[model samples]
Target chain A: MAALSPGNQGVRLAVRYLVLILIALIFIFPLLFMLMNSLKPTEQLLADTSSLRAFLPVGDLSLDNYVDAFKRAPVGTFVFNSVLVTGVTVIASLFICSLAAFSFVFLDWVGRGILLSIILATLIIPFETIAIPLLLIVSKLPWFGLNGLEIGWLNTYRVQIIPWIADGLTIFLFVQYFKDLPSELVEAARVEGASWWQVYRRVIMPLSGPVLATGAILKFLVMYNQYLWPLIVVQEESYRPVMVGLGYFFQLNVAWGEVMAYLSLITLPVLAFYLALQRAFIASIASTGVKG
Target chain B: MARVSLKGVRKSFGTADVIKGVDIEIEDGEFVVFVGPSGCGKSTLLRMIAGLEDITDGTLEIGGRVVNDVAPKDRGIAMVFQTYAIFPHMTVRENVAFGLTIKGVPKAEKAEKVAAAARILQMEHLLDRRPSQLSGGQRQRVAIGRAIVRDPAVFLFDEPLSNLDAALRMDMRLEIGKLHQQLGATMIYVTHDQVEAMTLADKIVVLKDGKVMQAGSPMDLYHHPANLFVAGFLGAPSMNFISVDTRSVDNGLAMVANAALDPIEVATTGRDIRTGSRAILGVRPQYLVPSATPAEGMLHGKVTLTERLGAETVVEVGLNDGSRVIAAFGEDRILAPGTEIGLAFDPRQAHLFAEGDRP
Candidate 1:
């Protein structure tokens, strides 16, 4: 093999990095546009929409649109509701899905194969097909909470949190990861006198860092971006998640600045959550051969 | 130490029976090994004893108690797995102490037990290292240490040294032997390696297709294999079998003749022998000595191949009937291919099996 000269190698490296940077900028363009437009006034925001200047913080910038966005709707409550729902849903979803996957992968129960196939079959059926039936069921569900016997779960935090806790993809991810773990460890744990629960708690769960992160990130994204379900179910202001709350800024000629500000605000939690688990998520993806 | 016994144990997956009907009595403090080829049900039999596999149609007892329904942990046994099932996320100390911790042993006592196991395994300095950080042999020691900390009545090893390289496998083999001596625990080891079985087992159970072919001490199995399968499976170069025509018999001996070899007198051992009946003569490669010239009532063959090692040499001989027999000799002689050599076998050392015989 012939080796390239240092100058030639440097040029090749520069071109590769240039292509990567271009692709990264293409992906980040919308977020930059949102941030930049959120700082501008309404007139300037609309004026810069046609040009590259819209992505840059060039003309008039201030936090006035943020203040106006809060004044327009219960932005604080929407942000709170989305974060609460996503966080609780992520944690609960990870626990429930991973547990189910463990049982599906390890324990030899009757009909396990058919049940796993049924669950995997559900993955192809888009959630949109089941949305109305799921909504109808939750609408008439009864809850015996601090209020002692509520009739309906609609327009409540529990309605949002409960239905999204377990899904097919997250369980599949966990099952895929757990299947590769040596079965001997589980057998050894059993011989060590551990019950199946203890085996899962100590031996399996501790070694499941990457899959847990993968499951959590996926659940967070799914719950955070929930729009149709929350829009139809949650009529009260306090229960509306961020995606549904974005509609508040859409009325009466659409306060474009407030719209930009609300979008930028809602995108923060997703970015932060992803960044926190990006290392483990990437590790899980690499290990499990799963694409993002 | 514990005595484990299985009575007519059978295992089947659906319609396929893996272990037909196995009955074994393992004495206390005796190191027993189940050695067989793949798919021979040795591992399954061990798993049944460990209570990891349910007994399909029999009873299993450990330490005088029928433990067929007992959980693996409650059966008073700890198994070292072939994969060295050390937790990759935990330090060596934590992995070793896992069983005691799960049993809710007090923290101080757990520490003492873990420390003692680590010391015995020579893993004191490696207690803080994760499994990924340790070498293959060290990780296996940690696995053994895990089983030791439990202090169970019986220790089960499932091909625990098969994953290591050749040199490490020998080293680990010696270490496991020493560990068995030091602990004096009743250990049941399963391996496909006959050498491991020969070197470490106080009692060896040879299995073929879920049935115990023969169970005895190493020397007993080696010298007196009951059947053709056991004879072929026990040794490295393997025992050679030559078909002979029994022409006549006299005085408790059969006069056997094969083409290209002289007729010899083989002891019938009181078995029914008729004239013109086919029989097989069995002799180990180590017993087939190479002679300089043709001798009376001897087998002769042309040398087809020769392998020379430092300590010994193995030579393959082609008989006139298109079958080959291997002869192993000490490094005193090296014969080239195509060299004609006469092979002599002591009548007392040779084994003869009638057609369709089991023992």
Candidate 2:
């Protein structure tokens, strides 16, 4: 094969960047429209929906919608609830799921293969099929909290956080990552007098940064975007999450400007979580490709 | 240092038997090597001794105590793996001190031991670097340092140098030899490389198909291989096997003859051999010397190929009976293809195996 000339290389490079820029614009257009129209009045917001001006912020704008968005509903409590549940679930899932994965990959026990197969088989079953039964189970479960021995777990942070702690996807991610690690490290650790717990905490977890970041990002998205489960379980205003709280903007006469403001507000936590873990997530993807 | 013994040790995974019943005795302060081809249960036997694999039958003793059910840590053995198995997240100092840390040793004592091991391996300057920051040879040294810090009763090595390049493998082999001398610990090393086994071990155990073929000093096994398998497995350019028929068995020697040569007396230990039974004669390539004339040589053949390797020349000769034999010469010889050549060897340096005798 012949090498490309300098002029041809320049043309190819420019074309590549042009294609990438077009893709970038396609993804960013919706976010641009949301941010721009959030600053306009409801009349201008609805009128400009069919034109490019809706994404340009050229119409009359003010801080009225932002102020009204907070006053109309308990937006602060909703964002807080979502962040709290998502953060706790992400942390606990990384711990419990990684432990389960560790047991599956390293330790030998009876029925291990069958049990792993059963757990992975859960991935094919959509949550919609089991949501009703899951809601019934969590509603009657007892909790020992500040008001010791609570009879039911409805309208509580634990209700959202505990059930999502050990799921099939997170555990599967950890198992695949753990399987790629060299088994010799575990044997060497054992021969060096390390207990099983020490191997998990010191040796395995330290090497699991990329997988942890990946699992955290995935679980955060799933839990923060939760709507159906929280809608059925938590009817109290104080326990409502961001997705269910979006319903408040859809009353008899919807406020388009205030709705955009609520969406823009709720999208902040997910964006921040992803940006913080972007490097590790990319590293995990690149390494997985290389290993495969 | 401690003595290690295996009494009828065997291993099975499901219905397939990996390691058949075998026995071996290793003395204190001795460097023993288990050398064999792939899938010969060498690594499995080493793991069984380290308590990494469970024994299916029989007993294993370390320091005069049966430790079949003991955990790897409690058995007082440290193993160096083929992959080095150094923790990529930890520095060399931390890796070396891991065992001591698990034991809850005092900080000063742990530091002292780590320093001593680093000094022994000559890696004190690399103590602060992670495994990813070091080369393959350096990572292997860190692994050895980790083992040294434990100061265990025995050291186990599972093909530790197989992952290194040729030059690095030579350098590490010498370093391991020096370490064994410096520490004077009982060690069991496993490798398929016979050069390593011949050079580094005080005793060499050869295995084939999960059974012990022979176990003795390196020179003893080389000179007196019990069967045809050991004869071919031990030497490079291996021993040349030629089929022959025994004419008569007198005293301790057998007179053998083949179509390519006259009757020659070869040494054997079998006492139940018949007078006219088939046998094999084993002779090393180095023992075959060139003769001036075919009439005066014990064997006569035509040179088929020659490999001139600077200091020595190896020649492959085809016998009249449609068989081939290799001969290595000390000095370079100009024996081209299709050249007629004659070779001779001493009877004492040759081995004879009867049709079905075990040694």
| Candidate 2 chain B weakest lDDT stretch, 10 residues | B292-301
Sort candidate 1 into its docking category: high
User: Tens digit of lDDT per residue, candidate 1, span B1-359?
Assistant: 89999899999998999999998999999999999999999999999889888889988999999999998989999999898988888899999999988899999999999999988889899999988899999999999999999999999999999999999999999999999999999999999999999999999999999999999999999988877888888998998888889989888888887875678887877666668888888888888887767665587789999988868889899987777888899775678889888888777787778877653
Query: Using alpha carbons, what is the TM-score of model 1?
Result: 0.97
Give the docking tier of candidate 2: high
Identify the runs in model 2 with alpha carbons over 4 angstroms from their true place: B294-297, B357-359
Show the lowest summed lDDT stretch of 10 residues, model 2 chain A.
Answer: A283-292
> Which digits, one per residue and each the tens of the lDDT, describe model 1 over residues A1-292?
8899999999999999999999999999999999999999999998999999999999889999999999999988999999999999889888899899999998989999999999888899987898999988998998999979998898899999999898889989899888989888899889988888998999999989998998888788889999988988889998999999888888878889989999999899899999999999889878866432
Residue B317's lDDT within candidate 1 is 93
Q: Lowest lDDT 10-mer window, candidate 1 chain B? A: B290-299
In order, what are the TM-scores of chain A for the candidates? Answer: 0.96, 0.97
